[model samples]
Target chain A: MDPDPTIAAIARWSGIAPPNEAARIGLADNAALITEIEAMRGTMGFEEEPSDFKAALRDCREPTP
Target chain B: MNAPVAVTDLASLSMTEAADAFATGEVAATALVEACLARIDAHDAVVNSVIRLDREAALEAAAAADAARAAGRPLGKLAGVPMMHKDMYYRAGRVSSCGSKIRRDFIPGVTATVLERLDAAGAIDMGTLNMAEFAQNPTGHNAHFGHCHNPWDPAYCTGGSSSGSGAGVAARFFYAALGSDTGGSIRLPATLCGVTGLKGTQTRVSRAGVMPLSFSCDNVGPLVRTARDAARFMAVTAGHDPRDPTSAREPVPDYEAALTGDIRGLRIAVCETFFLDGADAPVVAAFEAALDALRARGAVVTRISASSMRAINAYTAMVSRVEGAAIHANWMREHPGDYAIHLSARLFGGYAFPAHLYVEALSRRGPLLRQFVAEALTGHDIVATPTLKTRVPTLAETDIDADPANWSRFMAVSANTRPFNYLGLPTISIPCGFDDRGLPIGLQLAGRPFAEATVLKAADAFQRETGWHCKAPAL
Candidate 1:
């Protein structure tokens, strides 16, 4: 089986997030993070992402145990 | 008569030698323990490596071991060896400051699994060692407790966040000690202190009850006088733990058996791109010499294909930052001024790690870890590289507030070591040589997932042949 959605998404993003961020926020805010994620997706070529990846983010953002 | 009874001399006295002498009624554990306590009294004033010296308990433990042997009870290999634990690890009812005022009086009822394992193995618990506050900073300086000076050169850094483990082990106050690495804490200090450090594969050793740094990256391992000593420690401390899900369920190997030092046909790869670049002349020279030494000792060494190191470094940055930030997020928000200024931005910054980036960095480690385990080390038993890339810098030089060049170089030099933590692989750093300043430099050998035996074999062989790891800084 393939890796979990959130993990795979992280893998995708791990390739793209530029090291130039002044801070993590700056890193996230800079188009660099998204750009890298998108680029990695293009390289391996994932057309659609798992819905759970987005849901996991919502849970992490909310932190509801 | 006894070389002034230095800690270095004591540590240089092998655990095997000491244990044998003690068993044969030649030397008493009480005598060795007293020697360490006396040395701590004399040189610790200069090193400041030990934060809390538990004399009463240490003597009691020593006396008990002597009693056990006298009673004809077969003792463990590390019987009567004196050691310390980094303050980040909880000692029942003792305050584990994590080097910050935030938890100054915070004590735990339970002890760390590694410490429990050490106790079971028959090591004398000398006391708690110093560290970078909250295991956040890699440099040894602590804003709250005070800086732990390098034993080789008091002015130079001992490296952190395992500052005291490195220094205490180096100075001989203890034969071996425990250090945790989130992002190169154990290896950095091991290299800087000129000792043997094993950052056992993540989850290879239990992490239950230790202070958290980065949950994903953090691991408990030995910082010792030699890899053999480290292996002795690993043999006892390793095993599946019901308390920590991350702890491996695999059976612990015969670390002593792995130490025969015969790597005749072992496939060992030397990483060129990230490890070899941007290193100082002295470090580069020592590393090349180490490669030569290993080759002469009969092992294959070749450069493996490396991806963009920046990508790996970037991943380490986010994963550690986000997780570390998460750990301290509460304490930091509660008391901002309580933390070292250098760690402040890094921890709080984890929250700012766009939710996507944090998850992305966390997720990214999966494939790479599996692939490296499956392919890169397919034929290779172990991989070799410089543990660190620069000569040891001074604590005064790395104040983050004081020297940007020193801080950046400090961060960059660790590029060789941190990826293993990111990949959750076992890595060992063995002292390779000394620079002109007399500080120790280390060479890192990383092994496949759960292949700690190979890592131990390579390190133990290199150490036995070179004797670099046995050399101690005159305190």
Candidate 2:
């Protein structure tokens, strides 16, 4: 359940280490958030790409003359 | 040859009123600028809303505007209006500290497109206002320039990132200010400070030359006195910009003209779900009253179910944080110590999120948007909610930097507003009523994507029926 090691490892990979204990706590919370978001991935389709967001906005717009 | 308008009366005029007054030669631009300067000089110390006061440059611009009027030259829509902006909007060769210590002296070579548009509209830029550091935190807590105090009650928090823009507008220091909303930055302050704020659909406004927090979610908008003022501000600033290719090509309608104050048959949906969870009694009372007023204005209100909000909220945080982390990766590597402790910590966590998860969050955005629209706006012209789920908290209670334990209250300040950012919809916040503590409360209205006109029309109609927006702080 300790996210410190993973966070530290990722920090090293990203070229920035956690600056303090508060950062580690924040990272732990982020880890929880990521888990929650990942669980929702089942609702997404394999065909969808990040760029589809803009098209979605356009499609949902209220049509004007 | 007419007598000059009194400084107090000029300072109190809304942006649209000032513009109209100037157009008809009822007041000179110099007098308007001077009125704003006098208010800032007298009250800004208590509000702590101003970061820089460009008194000389503003007067020069005002004089030019007055001269143009005397010559009977053409004028822009917002001609002769005086305003300030959140310090993150860049002006060529002028310092835009972005409410951070690291960029305390960073000046950009290019002016923000919104500033250029505001200038072309003949609005005088008085100066820049305070904000959350790098426009990150939701609560108006800045360890660098000092937290922006609510004009209603200095002890209360001005919901931020757009802190000073909200406070300054409320205190009548200026008529309007540009505030960027990544995740409720503009709406939070608008609600907390009792002003009007609008965030068009994502990409509705250009971001070129402005500081970036989350590339996908960041929005450029205005904080003003009433929805009518917001409509005018948007008419000036919302449109495509060549410099910002991401800016939407959607035609910018005459937002002010759309404010006919006739909203008969407007279908407004109210979700009795996540947006209202754990709502404060006072907040609920004020929100219900606002709904009653809107109902009195011939708008149809319906209760709807929204089950996609939790996922929407989570994905929004993921995408914004990851993008923000990527933007600040270099600085975090070289000078993490330069940031406030809480900001640096938040950025540090951003670097830890897995890349796949980031992609997953973005990938789901389209599906989520479609679902939300179908569920919330399929039969509705607008979705209505209380801008904040709880009563306004004081600075002492929400300052996470002082005590990390304050994080929950701090984060909750933005809970109701953040989902709209992820939805990428056009949304607005207007003063609804005051809490038992005499602080302002707000009602948020959202509409279909690219429907800024619809949103403003509804808000303007509500303002006509109710006088909440007219009641200013005693500052």
Candidate 3:
């Protein structure tokens, strides 16, 4: 995970040429959030839809407003 | 019955009170508008809350409302009430800067459906309020519009991206302001500025023409002086809008009618774990006192463990960050320099999220939400917590761009409030007490999905028993 092209490289490919220093630090700081995302792996059941609309609206007592 | 309002009391009259006075012929709409404008003129320089002040137009609208009343023509529920919204809500042909330099001159061809509803209810649009650039930050620091200072004490942060909305309402600049929340924008600001804010169930209000940061989590609501004001505002603004396909088709209940102020048998759940972890002494003290007040009102409060909250908070950020990054991808490519450095840096992280991870996070949202509701809200009518875990920080202390060390402090501003955005539950923040530094503290009450009436009922009951919501900044 440490050896691949950095977030900076991926961003450059996506055409967002932010300052190199800020980009590196920003991506590094985001590692924590990514780790949290990684923890969610294998947690979802296939029947569970990903959309918040589906989740939020499910079993909501009100008929859709 | 609403109390009779005098012209002199217009400056501090709650939204519902002002509206009632306008309807009863006790005060003219012109007088209320003038009182609000006078307050803005006197105190706005320090608060820096308003982005624009539509003086002539507001007066013209108020005069029309008065003319309608004089002629005994039909009037909307909010006849003659004045309000401003976060700069993001679009009004056709009007410049909605959205608190960003890139959109400073960009005008939309269509109006936000919420604005049309407010207009139909006879709310006078005073102007736009300041916010975090692109509604990205939790702290109300806007690099584009000067940082909106807290009305209580200008040195402290007002908590944002709805900074101006909270501060404007606290300063009594206007009765209330519309604020959109993705990651605690409305509640954070409301708590910090000592006002009331509500984020209804996701898609509970139409998002059409309002700026979007995270498509999944964005919620449009209000920051006002009292919960009843929020109730009236919600009743007018909420409902299915065909213009926004995602808008809930559920019927919009009379939120005001639910505020009967008798919470004798209400059940409040207190997750005493993640929400209170590392909370400051003053915050905990205020929260405990608020709980005691509720118990005195006959609410049965129960403490329980919500160990899943840590995970809930973690994934909430992931979803918003990914969506925000996607929304600004094109602009980041074209006009990257136009964004504030810190905001750009935050958005830059969004680009790094893998599509698979984003989908995983999104997919898990449903299961995780069910887990939370089942665990936290089974027999509970409302879950209460401090809106923010710490005392309000100074603007300088939370300026992440100025010093990256401030990142933790800046992030904590929304820690307790963001989970509801993910859960998509109806939630509200109301002033309960003040901290050591005298900044206001908020008691957040989150209800079940689409249970806004229950949320407002609890909040309005609290207001009836306490005078916190009536307190305003000396400024």
Model 2 clash tally, residue pairs? 0
Residue B396 error, candidate 2, Å: 1.1
Name the runs in model 2 displaced over 4 angstroms. A1-3, A31-35, A38-41, A44-51, A63-65, B1-8
Which residues of candidate 1, in runs, are more than 4 Å off? A1-65, B1-11, B308-310, B403-407
Q: Which has the higher TM-score value, candidate number 1 or candidate number 2?
A: 2
Task: Give the TM-scores of the predictions, in the order they appear.
Answer: 0.87, 0.96, 0.96
Top-scoring candidate (DockQ)? 2
Q: Give per-residue lDDT, candidate 1, residue A35.
A: 61
lDDT of 3 by residue, B56-172 (tens): 999999999999999999999999999999999999999999999999998999999999999999999999999999999998998888999999999999999999999999998
DockQ of 3: 0.40
After superposition on all CA atoms, what RMSD does each candidate show versus the true structure? 8.2, 2.5, 2.4
CA lDDT, candidate 3, residue B363: 74
Per-residue lDDT of model 2, residues A1-65, tens digit only: 23558765765688788776667667667656757666766764343444588999999988554
Ranking by TM-score: 2, 3, 1
Residue A48 lDDT in candidate 2: 49
Q: Please tell me which predicted candidate would have the highest lDDT against the true structure.
A: 2
Candidate 3, superposed: residue stretches over 4 Å from native: A1-4, A20-23, A37-52, A60-65
Clashes of each: 4, 0, 8
